[model samples]
Target: MRNLIHVLFFALVVSFSFSCKEEPRTPPNILFIAVDDLRPELGCYGKSYVHSPNLDQLAAESSLFENHYVTVPTCGASRYNLITGQLPKNPGDLSNQASVSNIANKPAGERPTTFMQELKQNGYYTVGIGKISHHPDGYVYGYHEPKSDKIELPGSWDEMLLKAGKWGTGHNAFFGYADGTNRNGMAKEVKPYEAGEVGDDGYPDGLTAELAIEKLKSLKQQDKPFFLGVGFFKPHLPFTAPKGYWDLYDEENIPLAPFAEIPENSSKASLQNSGELNQYKLGEEKPHLDRVASDAYARKLRHGYLAAVSYIDAQIGKLLDELEEQELAENTIVVVWGDHGWHLGDQKTWGKHTVFDNALHSVLMIKRPGESGQRISQVVSTTDIYPTIMELTNVPSQATLDGESMVSLMENPAAKHWRNTAYSYFRRGISLRTPQYRLTKYFRDQPPAMELYNHQNDPYESKNVANEKPKVVKQLMPIWKKGNTGIFKE
Candidate 1:
């Protein structure tokens, strides 16, 4: 009887121990990356000539969003719309200073203070490196001013770092070249593009990749899941990359921008004056609404831009390779996004300040471990990325996400009940994109205040048929007004 009792007790102890043994459940890690002024001109996006094998491989294993659009065509505004998961609430929010001029002042207790802050509060290690916000170095500082302790997205990051290198401050680095000379400091005397004879490390983006790789290893040692953001500055302005990337392209064979003339019957207010390109004082040619850069100079600019794209692609490949090396690729979710598309001489413009497709469309690719590659052609907005991240990680919070998740579309490209429209605001113009149309309503215009383009008929948006297509305008009118509620001053 004594032996029987002892055996029973031992069995009970063993059962309790087995039940209490903690099952290792590693939550999915998120590797979120953002590139500045990158359009979907890569080989994966079917731009046959672009030498982007790294991004092509990524897209091959992920859900490629062919028609991704940003809320605002400019950088700061588009990034704000993305990080906050909201539309531009006011006209001033459409400027290039959106993060600093708009969001950095609000209190943390207020509306969702950045999705990163929410993730950090929910026990995830959140780290931001390089131009994650309006500021290039992830901190707030005046143009040409020394770095300050004031952070843009306060309380959002457990670690914020940047190797500014020879670029000095973040703002200066925002427009720096491979030789450590910046656009502003050089007094605009430097050429708008450069093909450095040095290696990849001669540029800031190479150093950024180095930091990201180190961070990934550090994050792996932690017991909790992490949200790591690595923002690359390239293909933005003062296009400069190593000579090797430039050699990858034949400058003479590089194609000219598809659309260079302004749309017919569109108001002057509908297009930008290309002043952003003008800032490159040494640019061989100036582009305008009525005139475009010389074809030769335009080809040179395109070649430089493509070289920068390939350089950034190599850096991205480095980070991804390290993720797989650390055995983290199977459990990590990878996202590669471009803030907004740039006009490569489209619409007689070279910058991204218009409501046109060249300025609004961007790159959005997502890779879920163990998932096959699929293409989603629906019109999705950058604002949706925040909610999609939350859904993927199963993290709960008290936030009302303005964007919807793409989980269903990721699983099935033909998913039903998906959003068929997206909205973007720039200057006084409000552009709405449906599956088959691109409509614009300029708040500052009179009687002919509306503009419409049937994408089914004119993909280049070369004509505004608003007057001819009253029926289509009537159908999209209500959507335009509804989209204007928070964006317009009224």
Candidate 2:
């Protein structure tokens, strides 16, 4: 009788324990969309004429950063900043070959920790597609080199993928046009812009988006949340897009850059004479610092760039729609960021590698599910994205990130104590953007070594007031020097 009573008591205890147990909570997923050479020209950034419906819609539900800056102006270095959350401190790290120059050379024990690596360690299915790193397709080698077993982001992703369509190789695709002729293949005889009557598959961006959508669907089947990175190549060079996007723009209506002349009192060292622009031997105009590019050709280039933007937007829409279809939008965190801004004839120069606003300022948007729209006016760096992602996904990471967490401003756009200064490095010089001025100081110890622009008075950046603003430079000099410390640890 006593044994029976004890058994009944134990059964009751087991039932009580089982009833009190809690179900494990699912974590939020991350969709990190990296757009190349995308400046703040979308409708969301108050550019009334640009057609970017999909990204604008994304901005409606995201935290739009009005003052976002990249650590480096070039491709590979800027990506290194985004991936590793560190600023470039050496000249070698600032090149387009930074993947091969720096990261690829480092031993596994001495490499910096990528946030994506942290996510993979913490049970997230990390995936990469297209130009997430320097290489157009995330595999290594030159524009014509064959694919090998080189991985850029070591230990970061479970699967790193690149699908180059008719263009053949990633390097060729990067410099390719609508008719499948790469600039290299054509011996630089390609025009600066081409609007071919082709479908979305006519460009590599479409194929990248398609691949990402497929990966998204597959990622949903996994038990853990995913970190999917999708990168699109467009508006970089040899501006090419489908006919439908090109039709949206009227060539005559495209406006030229307001500040087409070089800045007053600025040294020649601060500018490049559209060398990248001069690469295409078939271009309609030859752009030089002393001579202005033809207005007609400038309009054509802008038209092509806009078409590329719209094409990528349509591709982005496809990815977003897929997320909704899979019911993953409810718990996924979406972030859209450009590697760096492009100089569309601004500052009488073309291409990046400049410390000017045209090259430094880019686009950044972060959307948390159910979060209200907010515009963050405080200046933020690209490095901050790593910590922000870590905080957003609730992942535990011991990674030492160079950037601060942007979550406070994400919650409250006007949050205090937020960093108001942004830093960008190039060559031996570093540029600092504060609330009022942009100060650039060179380290070579030459004449006209410093350039300063007062943003309030000269919104166009047509003048350099460094010689006149000695007191201001004195105050900002330390801050400018403080930006030079993102040196990687061995």
Per-residue lDDT of model 2, residues 1-490, tens digit only: 9999999999999999999999766788999998889988899998888999999999988999999999899888999888888777677778877766666767978788889899999999999998898888777776767876788777888999877888898888888787777998898998888888889988888888889999998998998889999988887887899989999988899888989988899766788788888988998888878888788888888899999999999999999999999999999999999999988899888788788989989999999998887888899999899999888878876866778989988887777788888888885678899878889877654557888999989977899898898999999988887886744221
Clashing pairs in 1: none
**Candidate 2: stretches off by over 4 Å:** 1-23, 486-490
Q: Residue 388 lDDT in model 2?
A: 92
- TM-score of each candidate structure, all chains considered together: 0.94, 0.94
The per-prediction CA RMSD against the true structure, in angstroms, equals 2.8, 3.4
Tens digits of per-residue lDDT for model 1 on 230-250? 999999988899999999999
RMSD of 2: 3.4
